[model samples]
Target: MTANTRAPQQERSRATQQRLLEATVECLVEFGWSGASTTVIAERAGVSRGAQLHHYPTRAALVLAAVEHLSERRAAEIRAEAAALTGDPEDRVEQVIDMLAAAFTGPLYVAALEVWVAARTDLDLKAALIPLEARVGREMHRLTVDLLGADETRPGVRESVQATLDLLRGLGVANLLSDDSHRREQLLAAWKRQLTTAIREP
Candidate 1:
C-alpha cells in the first residue's frame, strides 16, 4: 500500500518539475532574463512559488535547468530529422544545414541566448553554463559530422563542419532583430555549395 502511494507521488513530482522547467523556458523567451523572475516562472507554470523553489532553489538554477531540458529536446528533434533524411551525400548535407538553421532560429535558441547574455556577467551562471555548452557543442559537432558522412581525418573537413555551425549561429543572431530569413536563405544556399565542396573527399 505504501509503495503504491509513493510511486504516484513520485510521478506527480516528476510531472510538476517538468512543468516548472518548461515554464521557465517560456518565461525566458517572453520576458528575457531580467523579467523572468521566480514569481513569474511559478505563475507561468501554474505552480506555487514554494513549489518552484522546492524544485529549483534559485533563478539561475531554474533557468539553466530549463535551457538544458529544452536543449535535450531540441537535440532529439534534430536527431529524428536527421534520421529521416534519404538522399545523396550532398543532398544530406544541404538538408542538415537547413535543419540546423531552422533550429538556431527557434524559441529554444532564443532562450539560450538570453541565458548566455546574462551569464556573461553572472559568474555563478557562467560557471554552470560552461560544461553544459561544451557538452551540447560537442554533441552537435559529432552529429553534424555523422550526418554529413565527412572524413574528419582529411584536412579541413573538421574545420568546415565547425564553420558551418558558426555561420548558422551568426544567422540566428541576425534573426533576433528582424526577419533575416531572406538574407539567411541566400547565405545558406551559398554556404551549402561551399560546404559541399569542402566536405567532399578526393
Candidate 2:
C-alpha cells in the first residue's frame, strides 16, 4: 500500500474512532457506566460490533476514551463561558459556579458520578480518571486567577483557589445526590454567600 493510498483509510479510521467515542459517551449517559455494553454502543453508533472492536478492543479502553472526550468537551464549554463573562470578579465566579451546578444536574454529571463510584473499586478506572480530575483542578485554579486577578504563584492565592475548588466539588456531589430543588438552592445560596465573602474581603 502506497502512502497516498493509506491517507484516506487513516482518515476514515479516525472518523470511525470519533463516532465510537461519542457513542460511548451517549451510551454511558443513557445507561449507567456499568450498564453500557460494547454491543449497545456499537448499535448506537450505527456500526457493527466488529467495527467497534476494531476501535476499542476492550470495555476499559472505550470507557477511558469516552471520559477523555467528555473532559475535553466540558473543559472547552466551561472556559468559553468564563471568557464570555463581562462583570466583576465576584460575578464571574458566581457564573462559573452556576454553570458547574447546572452540569451537576445533567446526565453527564451522573456518568461522572458513576465513574467515581467505579473508580473506588477499579484500579484501571481510577488511573484513567485521575488525570481528568487533576485537569479540572488546574482549570479551576486558572479560572480563579483570571477572573479574580489573583496571583496564582502566591501561596495565599493558591490556598484560596484550592479551598474554592474543594467547595465546588463538594457542592457538585451534593447536587448530584439530592432530588430536592429547594434543598439544593439553599445549599447553593450558602455557598454563594461564602464565595461572596471571600471575594469581597479586603
Candidate 3:
C-alpha cells in the first residue's frame, strides 16, 4: 500500500519538475535572462513560488537545469530525425543540410543563446553552463557525423565538419535580429554544395 502511494507521489513530483523546467525555457526564449525571474517562472509553470524554490533555489540553478533539459530534448529529436532518413544520396544530402540548418535557428537555439549571452558577465552562471554546453556540443557533433555518415578520421574532415556547425551556429545567432534572408539562403546553398563536395573526397 505504501509503495503504491509512493510511486504516484514520485511521478507527480517529476511532472511538476518537468513543468517548471519547460517554463524556464519558455521564459528564457521569450524574455531573456533578466526577465525570467523566479516569480515569472513560477507563474509561467502555474506553480507557487514556494514550490519552485523547493525544486530550484537559485536562478542559475533553474536556468541551467532548463538548458540541460533542452539539450536532452533536442538531441532526442535530432536522433529520431536522423534515424528516419532514407538512403538516397541526393535526398539524404538535402535532408541532412536542412535538418542541421533548421536545428540551429529554432527555439532551442534561442533559449541557449539567451543563457550564453547572460553567462558572459555572470561568472557563476558561466561555470555552471560551460560543461553543459560542451556536452551538448559533443552530442550535436556526433549526431551530425552519424546523420551524414561522416568520415571524421579522414584528413581535414573533422575540422571541416566542426566548421560547418560553427558557421550554422553563427548564422543562427545572426538571424535573431537580422532580416537578411536572401543572403542567408544564398550562403546556405553554397554551404550545402561545399559540404557535399567535401564529403565526396577520394
Candidate 4:
C-alpha cells in the first residue's frame, strides 16, 4: 500500500487506541477495576468489543496499557517543566517540589489508585503491574535527579531524593481520603527547607 493509503488507517488506529485507553481510565476511576470490564470499556470508547479485544486481549492488558498511556503523558510534562527550570537554587527546589506535589493529586493518580487497589488480589493484574511499575519507578527516579540537579555522587543525596518521592507517595495516599492540600503544602514547604539545608553544605 502507498503511504497515503496507510496514513488514514494508522491515524484511525491511533485514535481508537487512545479512546479505549481513556475510557479504561475513566472506568477505573469511576467504577473501580471490576467495573472497568472490557465490554464496558469498549462501549464507553464507542468501539466494538471485537476491536477492544483485538488490541488488548484481556482486561489486565487493557488496564496496563491505560497506565502506560498515562505514564507517557506525565513523563512528557515533567521533562518540559524540567527544561524550563530557572531562578536561584531555592526557587528551583520549591518549584520542583510544587510540581511533584501536583503530580499526586489529580485524576490520573486517582485512576492509578484504583488500579493498585484492585491489583492487590488480582494475580494477573499484579504480574503486569509489577514490571511496568518498576520501569516507571526507574524513570521517575531519573526525573527526580534531573529536577533536583542533585549530585548523585554526593553521600545521601540520592537517598534524600528517594525520600522525597516516598513522602510524596504517602501524602498522595492521604489526599485520596481527605482534603490534604493544606497538609501537603505544609509538608512540601518543610521538605524544601530541609532539602535546601542538606544540599547547600557543599
Candidate 5:
C-alpha cells in the first residue's frame, strides 16, 4: 500500500516484462514459432507461467511485443550511429546504408523472420503484425530520409529511399539460409551508388 513498496513492485514488474520479451525472441530464433510457446518463454525468462501471462497473455502478444521492443532499440542505435558520423556528406550516406544493412542482418531481423513465417498461417498473428510492420516500416523510411538529409519532394527521391529499404529487406531474406555477407556487401555497394545518384539528381 505504501508508495515506496509500490515503486519497487512496479520496477520488478517492468524487469519481468523485459525478460519475457527477450526470452520470446530467443525462443523464436532457437525453436521457431510452434516451439516458442508461452510456457517455453516463461521458462526461458525464469519467470513463472502466471507472471508471463500476467504481462503478455498469449504467445502472439509476447512475440509481437518482443519484435516491437527490439525494433525500437535497433532503430535508436541506427539514429545514434547516424549522429556520430563524420567526414564528407557523401561518405556519411554510405555509412548510413551500411548501418541499415547491419540492421537487416541482426538478431531482431532473425527473430522477426520466424514470426513472419508463422503469421502466414495464423490470422490473429497476421493481424497484429500488419500494423506493427507498417509502423516500423514508416519509421525506418523516415529515419533513412533524416539520416541522408534526403528531399522527398525531389522527383524519384521517395522511390529511391523505398528502394533502399526493399533492397535491404531482400538481402535480409537471402541471408537466412547462409552467410550472405559477401554478396550482401557487393549488392549494397552497388545500390549505394545508384541510391546516391537517384537522390542527388536535380
Candidate 6:
C-alpha cells in the first residue's frame, strides 16, 4: 500500500480510537466499571466490535486508557483554575481550597469513587489509579505551596496541606453518600474555619 493511501486509513483509525475512549468513559459513568463491556462500548461509540478490539484488545487496556484520559483532563482543569487566581497569597489559597472543594463535590468526585470501587476488585484498575492519585497529590501540594508561600520541603507543610486535602476528600465522599446540602455546607464552613486558624498560627 502507498503512504498516501495509508494516510486516510490512519486518520480514520485515530478517530475510531478516540470515539471508543469517549464511549468507554460514558459507559463507565452510566453503568460502572463492571458493566462497561467491549460490546457495549463499541455500540455506544457507533463502531463495530472488531474496530473496538483492534484499538483496545483487552478490557483492562481500555479501562486504563479511559482512566488516564479522565485524569489528564481533570489535572489540566485544576491547574488552569489555580493559575487564574489573582490576589494575595491568603486569597489565592482560599480560592484554591474552594476550587478543590468544588471538584471533590462534583462529577469528578463521583467518577473517582466509582473508579475506586472498581479498583478494589480489579487489579488493573487499582494499578492505574496509583500514579494518577500521586499526580493529583503532587499538584495539590504545589498549588498549596504557591498560594501560601510555604516551603513545601518544610517538615510541617506537607503534613498540613495533606491533612487539609484528606479532610476535603472525606467531605466529598460524605456529601456523595448523602443528599443533604446543608450538612455539606456546614462541613465546608468548618473546614474553612480550620484553614483560617492554621494560616494564622506561627
lDDT of 5 by residue, 23-84 (tens): 98888888878888888889999999888888988777888899898888889899888888
lDDT of 2 by residue, 53-138 (tens): 88888887888778777766766776777778877766765776677666656666666666777788889878877887777658
lDDT of each: 0.90, 0.73, 0.86, 0.86, 0.89, 0.75
Per-candidate count of clashing residue pairs (backbone under 3 Å): 0, 0, 0, 0, 0, 0
Ranking by lDDT: 1, 5, 3, 4, 6, 2
Clashing pairs in 1: none
Worst 10 residues of 6 by lDDT: 146-155
What's the best-to-worst order under TM-score?
1, 5, 3, 4, 2, 6
Screening candidate 4 with a backbone cut-off below 3 angstroms (N, C-alpha, C), the clashing residue pairs are none
lDDT of 1 by residue, 1-202 (tens): 5987999989988999999999888988999889988998899889998888888998888878887899898889999998899878878888999899999999989999999999999999999999999998999899889888899999999999999988878888999989999999998899999999988857
Over 1-202, each residue of candidate 6 has an lDDT whose tens digit, in order, gives: 8999899999999898889877887887788767878889999999998887888888777777776677666667787887788867657666777887777777656666777788878887678778876776687667666655665554566677778878878878777656656876776677766665565556
- Among residues 3 or more apart in sequence or in different chains, the pairs in candidate 2 whose N, CA or C atoms overlap within 3 Å are none
TM-scores for all predictions: 0.96, 0.81, 0.95, 0.93, 0.95, 0.80
In candidate 4, which residue ranges exceed 4 Å CA deviation? 1-3
Candidate 4 lDDT over 28-78, as tens digits, reads 878776787888889999999888888888888889999998878878887
- In lDDT terms, which candidate is top? 1
Mark the regions of model 6 whose C-alpha exceeds 4 Å error after superposition: 1-11, 127-136, 143-149, 196-202
Between prediction 2 and prediction 5, the one with superior TM-score is: 5
Worst 10 residues of 3 by lDDT: 177-186
- 20, model 5: CA deviation in Å? 0.5
How big is the positional error of residue 165 in model 3, measured in Å on the Cα after superposition?
Answer: 0.6
Better by lDDT, candidate 5 or 1: 1
